[model samples]
Target: MTVSFTETEAFKTFFYAGEIRLLYFLMILMAIDIFTGLAKALKNNKLWSRKSLFGYARKLLIFCIIVLANIIDQILGTHGGILFVTIFFYIANEGLSIIENCAEMGVLVPQEIADKLAVIKNEKGTSVTTEIKEEFTSSHSRDLEGDTAEVKIKIEKD
Candidate 1:
């Protein structure tokens, strides 16, 4: 029998939250962030094994969070509402970190992206990734104390 649709495939249902494309995007962002972060650390001559492991662990934690969100969706039958929310938040968080990393590495990140990242970073309050990045690359980090507009990104990684 010819297969009609794989939307309900067990593999996709178990591994993905809602849409496979969204998970793909999230995975791409995670990979980009990881590589850029490693590059930034290498350029700064400050690659620590512990921090690197923690970074990888944190990435693993993303999957754990997704699983929890997926379970919640299954229980509540919310149709991936929780999962989508969780994934979208992570995307923004990772995107902001990536932009910051690229800019700090002197990659000439456009002002529009820099400005937008600042907005998102402000929203993604007290990110561990941001803290670690700042810890290693404070020399090039910009001051955010003067921004008037406020955006609060609620990431519960602590």
Candidate 2:
């Protein structure tokens, strides 16, 4: 007996929203992030088996969320908006983590480059990927101020 094409897992996955290249890039970034994180942890003598398992589980959950976002996009008759946004968010998040891991490993990353990666976003009222690129480019030269905390003191003398 022969199974129909629609009855195959490949067909179902192929119909998921978003371009294949985006998914490929996400996978690459995730792998890099995991590797760097492990290296950093090992360097600090803080590597734990349970923490590694948790990291794997987190990556699995990310893929599941992307699938759900793709389904939502299909239900809304849209072309990969949810999928794109979800993937973009993860990519930026993982990229930032990878950068931090590198820093922890004693790799020097320029402040401007780190700042650019931190500001990568898919803002409302703009093209998804385009806005991310634009923001990264523009944020590089922008100064980011540190948040300030206020302290109060009261003294009474009689």
- Reference-based TM-score of each model: 0.67, 0.64
Summarize candidate 1's per-residue lDDT along 109-157 as a digit string, tens digits. Answer: 8888867656645555644556675665435344554558978999898
| Deviating ranges (above 4 Å) for candidate 2 | 1-15, 114-158
Q: What would the C-alpha RMSD of candidate 2 be, to one decimal place?
A: 13.4
Q: What are the runs in model 1 whose C-alpha is more than 4 Å off? A: 1-17, 116-129, 132-158
Cα deviation of 32, candidate 1, in Å: 1.1
Encode model 2's per-residue lDDT on 1-158: one tens digit a residue.
99966557564454445666887888999999989988988898989776677678879888888888877877786676777888899998888778767865879889897566445533553234334434544354363346567899999999
Query: Candidate 2: global Cα-lDDT?
Result: 0.73
